[model samples]
Every structure is written in structure tokens, then in C-alpha cells.
Target: MSKYESVYIARQDFSTAQVEALNEKLNETLVGLGATVAKTEYWGLRSLTYRVKKNRKGHYTLFQIDADKDAIAEYERQMRFNEDVLRQMTVKVDAFEEEQSAILRNRDERGSRGPRRSGPRQ
Candidate 1:
């Protein structure tokens, strides 16, 4: 088995319900392939550094998984064929070092800022 991370962008026109459904289906597919999904994160709609499919923004989702090479190949193939997915990329990783990097960054930011408060317009 190999550790991997996949990041995908979905079309911007999907309704909130459709987006949620897509995420659910993707998770199911990964589990069905016998992959252990370590974590899944939604980066939310963000502007593309460059236009993709003539859209300036798209919704992003990230998945960290452990599976064999064949499983990863199949996952990428399915993603390409899925109409909801605009783009996807998968990369192998030696371990979960990226997770530790994220934790460290979060800790550094916390030390520099106090808890944020939300309020209505004054």
C-alpha cells in the first residue's frame, strides 16, 4: 500500500446539495476500493490562478488515502470520467508529514492571533 493525496476541483455551477452529494459519492468510492481514507478537506470555492474551462473559480476538495498503485489509478480514471469533477491530481507521499506541517503552521498562527469574534454591521 502507498500513501497518497488527491486534490480535485469541481464545476462552479453545482448547487450546494449537488456538491455535498458529490463528496459523499467520492468517499464511498474510495472506501469501496479498499483504501483507508485518512482525511478529507474542502478548501471551498476559490479563484483559479488561471481560468479553467472558462471558469474563474471552482470548489476544491482534498483527500488523503492509503491504497495500492492500481487503486490509485482506478480512482484517477473514475475522477476523469465524472462530469462533476473539473480536474483532479494524485500524488504519492512517503508518510503523513504534510499533516504535521499543517499542524505546525496552525500553531504558529494561533500564537500570533487571538480568537476571532463575529458581529453584525455597526
Candidate 2:
């Protein structure tokens, strides 16, 4: 089996619980196809650089998978056909990283900064 990182943005209108249910369904489908999901992360709803399907923000989720090409293809196909999925991407990786993804890590790091000050420099 090869390693892959799959990320998707669910429609912003969906509740967190609904997004989580979608993740569970996808995981079950992958497992049924003989794939193993090593990690799952919900990055919560985040703003997009540009509008997608009329959505300004979306619920981000990531899955680290160890599976064959066929399984990956099937998973992508399913996601493509799902109405709630705003966008999805899958990348083949040499290996999975055990640590949290950069997005999540950066969120923590950014939390320490005080609120931004907006004014002309004195």
C-alpha cells in the first residue's frame, strides 16, 4: 500500500457534526475498500482566499491514508460526486507525518499573537 494525504473542504453551511459524519462515512468506505486511515483531522471552518461554489468559508478535513491506487481512486470519485464537498485534493506521499499538519500547528502559533492593530505608523 502507498501513503496519501487527502484533504477536502465541506460546504460552509454544514454543521460541524454533519462534516464529522461525512468523514466517518468516507473512512468506512475506504476501510471497506481495504484502506487504512492513519489520521483524521478536522480543521474547522476557515475562510477561503476566493469564493467556491458561492461559499466564503468551508469546513476543512484531512485524512492520512495507506491504501492502494484503486482505493484512492474510488475515494476521490465518491468525494467528487458528493454535493456537500466543496473541493478535494489527494497527494501521494513518501510517508505519513505523525505530527499535526502545518495548518493546525500554525493556528496554535498564531493564537498567541494579540489582536492586530490597524493604523498608520506614527
Candidate 3:
């Protein structure tokens, strides 16, 4: 199995429920293909660098997944067949990325109670 990340953009006009449905379908597809989805992050609706499908903005979502090459192929195939997905990209990760992902996941699970804190202190 290989570690990969998939980033996709959905139409900006979609409702919150629609977005969640799309996300859920994506997860199901990955799992059905024997992939383990480590995490999924919603980047929210944002302006696009260029228009896609006549839209100037889209809702971005990121997925961290581990699966074989065939799994990725199937995921891409499904995405291509889905009208809701505006754009998508899948990339393989190296050892360094795997390590970095572990660190990030640990940080997320632990919350922001570390030595450094963000924002203004009162």
C-alpha cells in the first residue's frame, strides 16, 4: 500500500448538506477500494485561481489516504464520473511525508495545548 493525498474542489453553489453528502460518498468509495482514510479536512469555499466549469469559486476538501495504486485509480474514476466534483488531484507521498503526517495527526489529536499558543494573549 502507498500513502497518497487527494484534494478536490466542489461547486461553490452547493449547500452544506450537499457538500457533506459528497464528502461521505468519497469516503465510502475509498474504503470500498480497500483504502484507509487517515483524515479529511474541509478548507471551505474559496476563490479559484481560474474558473472551472464556469465557476469562479469552489469548496476545497483534502483527504489523507493509504492504499494501493489500484485504489487510487478507482477513486479517480469515481471522481471523474461525479458531476459535483469540480476538480481533483491525487499525489503520492514519500517517507518524509509519512513522518510529517504522523506528526500532524498527533498534534491534531492532542489539541493546541502545547508550549506555543496562537492569537492574542489576555
Candidate 4:
């Protein structure tokens, strides 16, 4: 089976718990179609570059999967019909990365830098 990286943005009005439930629902959908979801990550509510579906922000989620094209097609099809899903994308990849995804890695980096200095710039 080929590998893939899938990401989706949920409508901003939803709570974190609701986003998690959506993620679980999607995961189950893939599993039902015989796909193995390797990783699931929630990036939390983030501002979009521009508005989408009348939403200024959204809850981001990522899924790394090992599955065939048909399974992914079905997955996207399901996402297309979900009103809570603002947008979704899936990309075919040669292989899956074993470490954390860049989004999460960058988030950790920013968080580990500690609080910002309040002093004025020179």
C-alpha cells in the first residue's frame, strides 16, 4: 500500500472535544475501508490566512496513513459531505517520516523558547 499525508481544518466554532470526535470518526471511516492510520495530530485552533466558509479560524488535524488510492478517495468523499470540515487535503508520499510532523515540531520549538521579553528593541 502507498503512504499518504492528510490534513483537514474543522470549523472554528467547534470545541476541542468536538474536533477530537470528528478525528475519531474519520479514523474509523478509514479503518472500515481497510486503511491503517499511522498517526493523528491535532494542531488546535489557528487563524487562517483568509476566511473560509465564513470562518476566520479553524481546528487543524493531520493523519498519516498507509492505504490504497480507493480508500483515500472514499475518505475524501466523506470529508466533502461533512459540513463541519472546512477544508481537507491528502497527498501521496513515497514514505512516511518516523518523527513528529513539522507543524507540531515548530509549535514545540516556539513553546520551549519561554516567555517573550517585554523590553523595547534597540
Candidate 5:
């Protein structure tokens, strides 16, 4: 099976729990198809550069999986038929990266930075 990285944007109105459930359903589909899901990350709600399905914001979710071509095709088909999903993309990758996605890494870096201080005159 080949490695693949996939992302889907859900309608902005969905709560976090709803988003989780959607991903779980997709994961189950992959598993049922004899595919392995490596990582599933929720990137949180984010503003879109442009509207999609009349939505200005969306909940972003990422999936990294090892699966055959047929499995990946089925996954995309599922995404298209899902009413809650706004957009989805999947790409074939030579290998999976062990590190967290850049989006999550950037979030962690921002959190790790200390808060700004002010009103100090030397």
C-alpha cells in the first residue's frame, strides 16, 4: 500500500465533537477497506481565503494513511458525498513524515513563546 496525506474542510457550523465524529466515520471506512490510518489531526476552525459552499470559515482535519489506490479513491468518493464537507484533497506521498503537520507545529511554537511584557524603561 502507498502512503497518502489527506485533508478535509467541514462546514463551519459544526462543533468540535461533530468534527471528531465525522473523522471517526471516515477512519472506520478506511479500516474496513483494509487501510491503515496513521494520524488524524483536527486543525481547528479557520478562516478561508474565499467562500466554499457559501461558508467563510471551516473546520480543517488532516489524515495520513497507508492504503492502496482503490482505498484512496473510495475515500475521496466518500468525502464528495458527505453533506458536511466543504472541500477535501488527498495526495500520494513517497513516505510519511514522523513530525506533526506544519499547521500544528506552528500552533505549538506560538503557545511556547512567553507572553509579551511592557512598560520597562532602562
Candidate 6:
């Protein structure tokens, strides 16, 4: 079995519960294929740099999977056939990071900075 990191964006129109259901489904699918899902993260709905499938925002999710190539291929195939999934990408990784993804970390940093000041050039 090889390690892989997969990130997927669900259509913004779906409710949080619906998104979670999709996540659960993905987990079940992978496990059924004899894979171990090490970690899963829901990054929440976020703005996209560009519109995708008429959506300007999407619910982001990540998965750290240890599985065979056939299992990974099956997972990708399922994602592609699912209409709620706006976009998905899977990449082979040497190891999975223990910390939150950069997007979530950036969100935390922005929140800690407090409100932005108006009229710069102080």
C-alpha cells in the first residue's frame, strides 16, 4: 500500500450535513477497498480564485489515504461520477503532515491579526 493525499471541493450549494455525508461515503468506500484512511479534514466553504461549474465557493475536504493503486483509482472514479463534487485531485505523498492544511492555518493567522486598519501608510 502507498500513501496518497486527496483534496476535493464539493459544490457550494450543498449544506454542511450533505458535505459531511459525502465525506463519510468516501471513507466507507476506501475502507471497503482494503485501505486505511489516516486522516480527514473539512476545511469548510471558501472562496475560489476562479469560478468552477458556476460556483464561486466550495466546501473543501482532504483525505490522507494508505491504499493500493487500484483502490485509489476506484476512489477517483467515484468522485468523478458524483455530481456534488466540483473538483478533486489526488497526489502520491511520501508522508502525511500532522498539522492542519495551509488554508486552515492561514485562516487562523488572519483571525489572530484582528481587524484590518483603514487608510494605510501610517
What lDDT does each candidate get? 0.83, 0.96, 0.85, 0.95, 0.95, 0.95
Tens-place lDDT digits, model 3, residues 4-97:
9888999989987788888898899899999999888776788999999999999888888999999999899989998989999999986324
Model 6: how large is the Cα RMSD against the reference? Answer: 1.8
Candidate 1 lDDT (Cα, whole model)? 0.83
TM-score of each: 0.77, 0.91, 0.77, 0.95, 0.92, 0.91
- The runs of at least 3 residues in candidate 5 whose Cα sits more than 4 Å from the true structure, single-residue gaps closed, are 117-122
Cα distance off (Å), candidate 2, residue 75: 0.5
* Candidate 2 runs further than 4 Å off: 114-122
- Give model 2's TM-score versus the native structure: 0.91
**What digit string (tens of lDDT, one per residue) describes model 6 on residues 1-122?**
99999999999999999999999999999999999999999999999999999999999999999999999999999999999999999999999899988978998998999788789676
**Selected candidate, larger lDDT, 4 vs 6:** 6
| Cα lDDT of model 2 by residue, 6-99, tens digit | 9999999999989989999999999999999999999999999999999999999999999999999999999999999999999999988989
List where candidate 6 sits over 4 angstroms from the true fold.
116-122
Q: Candidate 4: misplaced stretches above 4 Å?
A: 119-122
How many residue-pair clashes does candidate 4 contain? 0
True-structure RMSD, every candidate: 5.0, 2.0, 6.0, 1.2, 2.0, 1.8
Clashing pairs in 1: none
Looking at model 4, residue 108 earns an lDDT score of 95
lDDT of 1 by residue, 1-122 (tens): 89998889999887667777898898899889988888877766878899888888888878889999988888899998997788899999987655534634675777789767788867
Model 5 lDDT at residue 28 = 98
lDDT of 4: 0.95
Candidate 5 lDDT tens digits, 1-122: 99999999999999999999999999999999989999999999999999998999999999999999999998899889999999999999998889889999999999999987788878
Better of 2 and 5 by TM-score: 5
Poorest lDDT segment (10 consecutive residues) of candidate 5? 113-122
* Candidate 5 clashing pairs, residues 3+ apart or interchain: none
Task: State the lDDT at 102 in candidate 4.
Answer: 88
